[model samples]
Target: MVTTAGSAPTPGTILHLREQGFRVVATDIDPAAPGLYLADRGHLVPRGDSEAFLPRMRALCESEGAVAIVPLVDEELLPVGELDGDGLSVMLPRPGFVASCLDKYVLMRELSAAGIGIPRTWSASDPPPADVVADDASGGFVVKPRSGRGSRGVQLVGALAEVPAAVAASGYRADELIVQERVTGPEFTVSVVVWRDGGVQAVVPKEVLLKRGVTKYAVTRHHAEVERTCRAVQSALRADGPFNVQLCLDAEGRPRVFEINPRFSSTAALTVAAGVDEVAGLLRQAVTDGPRLTDTWREGVTMVRRWTDEFISEEEFASHGLAPAPTVPLVARGDDPAPRPRSTDPASGVAVRAR
Candidate 1:
């Protein structure tokens, strides 16, 4: 089962899982989400934060005989983490780790205490004393919500002096935000898949070339230090499931972890293409006696982004009890072909400009 079928990367996950022979059950608040149509069974459900969400999810799990649930969005992690009991596996980190990852300030402090390299971070309400901040190099600071997802509320101040204006513009209380010294370097998104017995399955690092809120274009790179940093994180946090780590290299080439998402990365498909197949592999491990996954994967794999469409007929929409928007045509146009078949060859469609 996969939640938030409307997200950008979820359709790929659902399709891949279906190909692996598991009956995919998809849920979303929007009836017309493309993934809802792609699944073996699709159900319209309340938003993750709503009071009715978990009860409805439990009902769906019982009815569909789902063995596990993959939550695609951050808001659903804490609530869905509760569903891990009763022979049901929630494909997320443990609940305590999930809670820590959600709060950026707390996460940073914990990692710092564990001797993991991280950006110098502080709560906005209790920023470092003036003397500490006075050494501000030309590089500025990053101001963002203490607990949030993606880049929605993030702001880059020109210098320490501009933090007040950025904070006032955000409309959140000072205590609700955090300030960190901005680090400059090429960024990376790393995937660390762990097993139920606290063993690391694989760690794949992708160097991001472009981005919006997530990695847009990335290429697989073999960085020993990056892998070491991520392994250290796993040892320190002990998140006994899949999680994504976002980090950057400092001037000395040491990895400085900036953020950690206690769930699958948006670039999980890239990990599959790199040959780890984390999503399907982890699902198999959760449900039955699956083979143990190894850390070996193809280096120099690249992932590119493009927009594609999924078509559904008007009758099919009505059959699924979804209301169709007038602006969206259910029938395929002459110029529009069916959604292209996914390439089995890892290097078939995307360019591999690995250096």
Candidate 2:
């Protein structure tokens, strides 16, 4: 297995994979990235240099006898797809399938062509006719870069007069921008793992918690609605591999497909916690016959951001040939007393302190 940025959130998926008994070789362009410290073997190469990076990855797979390559980052997906692993399998959908999922315009066209309900959309250059825009009951509309991800360059414009400036400032050519009728309702994410044989292996759905400025966050599981939308999206995409389909529950309580991510998404961690292990499924599909789809997800499970701080003691630091002096005091006199140090139990690495 290969992953980039080996940090929290993203690395959470890789760590889950490791717990499933798969040996992981983590690679990133930054050798000193914190995630490297967690992997069996961590490698670094020049940044944005996939051309030079591919050969090294091929060598690592050959040496380690790796069965598949799973990309955690978006940029790595296409390049890894292009690599000829020389029969060493890379666990991704067909190249065309991956591309179709990645390209928003293509995904929309395909979903629409398949009779899936989606927001009314058009190219920014050819803004909908004034009469049509006016006649639509949906008031505000969203304009965004057709190929962008992470909600980058996305705006909700309430009027047609706001579109030209929004498009101009979006850093996309007129043709690359798409204007869509903004669907008003709760947003949900449906994560589906598909096999090459056109089967839906697992479907996990999550409800999003949106704040003012932060990109939307998946905070809870909504099983009934999630299941409904997941089935709808799976049938629509005809997905072939691991993909994420996002949808909004429109005012009428109907799901409308919004965007599709071709690679693993941030929500993978939540699905794993919900007992739908996508990484394990990907590996299983790559190595053996695909596993039968099941509804094993645990609902009402919640995951919140957690922060852990570690303090290296003087003796421990010296044992590793580091300076013994403290860089920062562990406790200050007037400050709240520090808690007792907990045992460094390797299992889960979550320390338990006595009262």
Q: What is the TM-score of each candidate against the true structure?
A: 0.89, 0.79
lDDT per residue for candidate 1 within 193-292, as digits (tens), equals 9966888888999999998877899999999999998989889989898999999887788898989999999999999999999989998898886988
lDDT, each prediction: 0.81, 0.63
Per-residue error (Å), model 2, residue 14: 2.4
Report the error of model 1 at residue 49, Å: 1.3
User: In candidate 1, where is summed lDDT lowest over 10 consecutive residues?
Assistant: 346-355
Worst 10 residues of 2 by lDDT: 346-355
Per candidate, the number of residue pairs that clash is 0, 0
Candidate 1 local Cα displacement, residue 228, angstroms: 0.3
Which regions of candidate 2 fall more than 4 Å away from where they truly are? 46-50, 84-86, 129-132, 136-139, 211-229, 307-355
Candidate 2 per-residue lDDT over residues 1-355, each given as its tens digit: 5666434454565566677777776655433344444445555533223355555566656665777887766656676776535666666666776777666777788888887777877788895857656666456788887775566678888877788888888777989888887887887777787766777777777777663222245654655655666666666655567787777878878788888777666677778778877878777767766565565787776656444433546664333321122122233222213321111211211111100
RMSD of each: 9.4, 9.8
Clashing pairs in 1: none
